[model samples]
Target: MKEKEILINWMEEGMTSIPNVLLKNYRRLQLNETEMMVLLHIYSFSQKGISFPSFEDLSGLMTISSSDCAACVKKMIQKQVITIEQGEQTGYEFYSLTPLWNKIAALFESDARGESLQQAMTEEKDLYSLFEEEFGRPLSAIECETLALWIDQDQHDPAVIKAALREAVLSMKLNFRYIDRILFEWKKQGIKTVEQAREQGRKFRKPANTEQVSRSENAVPFYNWLEQ
Candidate 1:
């Protein structure tokens, strides 16, 4: 038989689809906004022939402080969410989401051994397939385990969650902490069924169902009316 082939769909504008496989790692690693931002920055920079950027560049681009950036980088490195390589810059480090990237790619070809991406990623398989293929290797151990655990817990793909995140970001520009909290809350509430999500929306709208009341003018004082 010929070797298995993998195909991923083209990225859509404003698509927030991150591989669902990373959710567990996301929580375990305690990946905050700055850290996640840095990883994504490195991922994007890699495309432009810049695989590793110093902490300075990362902080600068993400509009954060040097100390803050360094702290986040240290955390990512400690968690194995990213790898740091020394370079010309002080405290230089390189970061990548290699493990997450691979799991996303494997979404197309289900492995019978462990947690299956087949279920969570089926709806948005194309969205992540090629991305995984692009970042084939060089994954760290922590990321791999994190990916697997997250994949195990996820009944939904990152694609849908991303769309919701993007909408929330655009509307409220909430930080990653808020996004994670929201996802956690939604999952805890058993929002698996579409009908359940819809019903929740309906329930949420109940408070807004308040009837509009025209402003009532204050009654004029009796003495004031007499004076007039």
Candidate 2:
């Protein structure tokens, strides 16, 4: 019964709640173990209705000296993890963790954006590999630059670019200039999808006059995309 009473007394002493996000990401926020402990002590004091705990009060709860505690608090303020705000009483101040929470929110947003960018990069790399496989050699720097221009500057869809590459291969052109001409012609015709490109190919296969039929018989099986 005496031990049970002691446990009840400990429970009644109250608890301090720390944010799980801060505990998980404190190191990433550039805070060392000692600095983290100092922040925890301040949080505990705030929970108990003490807005600002002195260096002596912090030091009593920590293993560090009072001077060291003061230094840690100063560094945290400089890092913008905490701020000293004016209190209700003149000449009095309190530590606020608003800046620290803002930093954590920014970090979360950056991580989410980073993930999206990484996935895009992975898809672009796969597209490059497909080009290398078709050409049977790694692309030259100029060739890679041309491909990037098609995607970034020309705003061509990757699927459409792949369809243009297939057309170039079928015509036995198998060169960057010929593939670029195909893409230019498709863009001028407002072709935006693989299906649209295939429809254009079907139209090219049908000869309107005897002159076009004679030319087709003289050349390879594929349509000459450059002539169009």
Candidate 3:
């Protein structure tokens, strides 16, 4: 085909326009340029009815090697940026971009919420910073997402979340899973505030304290009654 004809034919076929939001915030999703390009190519292929592309096919469209492409795909799967679902008719597993779309949709929703979104972003960022400061290192993307879900999906107040973190810190377990368990237990008990959390802690200790006092009282009762 002539260069002009090739250009015309390609244009006639159509174009791929990535979501601007995705392009703008790719780094926040921990996607490197190569990974982003690979994802974009996969999206293009999916749109063109090629849902599952081999590493060689992916590497053909870019400068990356098949090894690198496979690595990127594995990393994305680990981070939950991509998932594999069984294809209906073929029974083959295909990479699904639903998780990626969900993250992008969350970003757009946050953007649409205006000031509340800004405040939420600030609060969530601050919470991550606080956890990192306590843990003495940066949080992984998964850890950050876990914290965000606590606030957004679980409807846990930031103060209550902080309280749980504090409890974890004091207990010498400054990890996301430990904090998550604390929050889970608090939710089960309907503890929705920092004060309620403190009250619940006291309630748990109260029983032990009362038991200790009862044991002491019982030990002295026989001798004390005889003396009286």
- The collision pairs in model 1 are 9-126
How do all models score by TM-score? 0.32, 0.65, 0.48
True-structure lDDT of candidate 3? 0.81
Residue pairs that clash (backbone atoms under 3 angstroms), model 2: none
| Local accuracy of candidate 1 as per-residue lDDT tens digits, 1-228 | 323322223332223444455544454446776677767776667665577777687778878887877887777768666665565766655455565455445543555433454555563454244223333543356544433433356644455345334433433433334434545556777666545544553444233322321232332111111111
Clash total of candidate 3: 0
Give the TM-score (vs. native) of candidate 2: 0.65
Off by over 4 Å in 1: 1-25, 85-96, 99-228
Backbone collision count in every prediction? 1, 0, 0
Per-residue error at 160 for model 2, in Å?
Answer: 6.0
Model 3 Cα lDDT, one tens digit per residue, 6-31 = 99998877778788878898888899
Residue 179 C-alpha lDDT in model 3:
78
Model 2 over residues 1-228: C-alpha lDDT tens digits? 699999999998789989899999999899999999999999999998898999999999988999999999999999999999996767788999899999999999999999978986786788799899999999999999999999889988888888888888767889999999989999999999999998887676666788877877875457777776
Q: Which is the better candidate, 1 or 2, if ranked by TM-score?
A: 2
Query: Which stretches of candidate 2 lie above 4 Å from their native place?
Result: 1-7, 87-92, 113-117, 155-228
A best-first ranking of the candidates according to their lDDT comes to 2, 3, 1
TM-score of 1: 0.32
| Positional deviation of residue 53's Cα in model 1 after best superposition, in angstroms | 1.3
lDDT score at residue 81, model 1, on the 0-100 scale: 64
